[model samples]
Target chain A: MDTLTTPQVINSEYLLKHWQGHRNLTRKVIDAFPENHFFEFTIGGMRTAAQLTAEILAMGAPALKSIVDRSEEPFSENRFNLETKAEYLTKWDESTAAINANWEELSAQDFHETFNLFGLYNFPVIQNIQYFIDNEIHHRGQMFVYLRALGITPPFFWER
Target chain B: MDTLTTPQVINSEYLLKHWQGHRNLTRKVIDAFPENHFFEFTIGGMRTAAQLTAEILAMGAPALKSIVDRSEEPFSENRFNLETKAEYLTKWDESTAAINANWEELSAQDFHETFNLFGLYNFPVIQNIQYFIDNEIHHRGQMFVYLRALGITPPFFWER
Candidate 1:
């Protein structure tokens, strides 16, 4: 993808490509997480590792859908009420693929239109796509610290 | 703080209380993100630092709204498209206050109801809250790395 385009220049293809990149990166990070630590690490009363994974999996689709539909609710407001890690992961994968599948459903014009995203404010669809990507990156940064606090070399950031 | 309670047992107050903890922690980490870095860091093919903050600020209120409405779209699907550090931080502060103000709107039974969260699937509102906190933790994990990569010492995790 051309690296010089502004966020407003991004389209469904850019979003799908970036989404896949994020999913791939997330998988790489998850692979490096020690199973024991997965349920046990805490930094100042924060969540356990298992809980973090569940959180990532949980928001994958809702956030993407919100960006796509330009809906006015937080992504977490709608949840599966999941009972298992497997379920959350399944949804995560499905959401990744959904971004690819639904890319075409979003018109180029949609990218230019501004959305309210819950009466919070309005941004172009393209900026929203960039936000989705940036969001994943921010979380990955935290996971690396989790690994380091546990003394692990997280997979290279570029491997994803 | 009862670790024994299943996520379902935790209501919005529990979630909000927990999230407040996350905010405190993240605030410390955010402090380490140098004013210059706040809008400028990049690793491999990733978003600029300012964009990351915007995503975080954008998600806060919308995510809560989604939980409250049990809606399928992201609360940010269209509300914001910030480009400056000042804009993002302003929004972030607004979101933080919004969370504190409206947290009481949630009832314990609200935790039991399933939410669609962008049609990704259904998860209890309670679990979704957990996800939100964990999500913040995950992203904060990324911020920690950003700080470290920049050769900065992050505050004590507990300091949050």
Candidate 2:
């Protein structure tokens, strides 16, 4: 077992906390959405946040599981199936749990190894992991703006 | 120079390219915003992309310079002063160049070292760097929704 396999470039624990913090913040944004708007509210031609949440759920656990199993599944957009906002949250929790379970299997060294993410882009494991976080954060930002548009006060950004 | 001051966790080269890539992508998003709505468009009371862009510029170059120079400046919201969309773009370019200049002074160890960001949060350099990227990505996502609301096609996310 080589020590460099788990490089200390970014502390592994910090990475875990960082991703989870963003997740927590995102969940709050979801909670703030009015039920009526969850499925129907959309800006421009973008997918509603419900659809976007589906996309996040599709990407998060599935992507991490793929990384842990050393599998490169083809990329796919999440299809909206849930009828209620609660159903979406239920799925989100399941995915979060899955990420936790799979995260334990990812050694620090794995973060440095290059892997094809969903058989789409080939980049180092760390960058691939970042893509997951970045994508979610991006969507979450949109959710925040949505809340404001609906005359809602969303949680502070740094709360997570 | 002791190498302890420049540990190699993540490749430094990759970090530079990653941040710069996001910046380029963000710039394109700015270009996509219509002049009339650049300052006026607001979703749910959220700041328009133009205002958000100003916040990014304030944080980007200014934050990095503080890190390199070891100063602790308080975080301030971006003030809306530009009368035209072109002025906002010019300021953004200036900030981008400043980030490039300041980035060189940050060594790998700096990523691990802790400093108070904007005199608020105290975290390692890497986390702070991640903050910069994450915040911009999040805002950019909002901008995407805004563009979509306006029936404009934002540049692809991965194009950066």
Candidate 3:
């Protein structure tokens, strides 16, 4: 009798779904900001929400592609010179599709395998993926404060 | 030939470990703040880092205890009136131990079960757990900016 009692809780598909949920909420945060404020607003010397979004856009699909291809590309947030809020949203949608495409290429075992993210931090691929999600949540949290200070109500955090 | 090819990428133990890593990093963010600034610092009308820490402290173990005991406790951050940074750290350590204690009471199946967290936000137990982690990362991100503004180098985000 093989005595492993617990069922598997999270698979690759579930992880993608979890991440996409956060991405969706983040999109709403981008939409909530005024057109000018998205790029120009800064509080307490932090980067504007648009700049932070640019960093997030730089990560997801590119990191997944690196992990999938075993490529050693250095990290850069300047791949797209997005200026307008609409342009940012377009890039965001493009990245979302790209993430889905790249996600399909990952095997389950690949998650446990280590990948040097952006030729920089060498951690398990799963941690790298989690970092992508965590970093977004971190920035979104700042954006939430930004929204609040701007007298705009951001989306409910739990909705994600 | 049953053809489910992917293995489980995350289990309850892994989830706990992941959350604990973020918690550990967050502890460092708290420690990085100056004694007077921890409670007093604010930017762009945001709450002080101390108040944000209060929210993180209020959630973790208490939420787990709610899930374990099947209680509908309304959320409150006033359980401990931590006046100093040291007191907050002490409470954080206590909560860390308490989170472990409450975690032991949760069976693997409990992660999928839905619990109305804090008499609000009816989400799966797993999501609630993620929220605890996400919420901390969010606040820590703010603290990071606060630290940077005050000319202090916070811990590297990737170290978690």
- Choose the strongest candidate by lDDT: 3
Q: Rank the candidates by DockQ, best first.
A: 3, 2, 1
Tens digits of per-residue lDDT, candidate 3, A1-50, equal 11122355566787898899999999999999999999998866778999
lDDT of each: 0.61, 0.80, 0.85
Task: Name the 10 consecutive residues with the lowest summed lDDT in model 1 chain A.
Answer: A1-10
lDDT, candidate 2, B1-160, per-residue tens: 2324222335555667788899999999999988989889877767878788888887888889989988998877664466678997887788778888888888766777899988987997777888888889988988988898888999988888
| A81-150 per-residue lDDT for model 1 (tens digits) | 5444455456667777776666766765666567875455476655555445545666666666677767
Instruction: State residue A116's C-alpha deviation in candidate 1, in Å.
Output: 48
RMSD of 2: 3.6
DockQ of structure 1: 0.08
Interface RMSD of every predicted model, in angstroms: 18.6, 4.4, 4.5
For the predicted complex of model 3, DockQ is 0.43
DockQ of each: 0.08, 0.42, 0.43
CA displacement after TM-score superposition, residue A23 of candidate 3 (Å) = 1.0
Residue-level lDDT tens digits of model 1 in B1-160:
2222322222234346547766776766766677788768755435555665555665667777767766678445336876555566566677888888767676655655678775664766655565565456556766666676677887775453
Output the worst ten-in-a-row residue range by lDDT, candidate 3 chain A: A1-10
Q: Tell me candidate 3's fraction of native contacts, as a decimal between 0 and 1.
A: 0.47
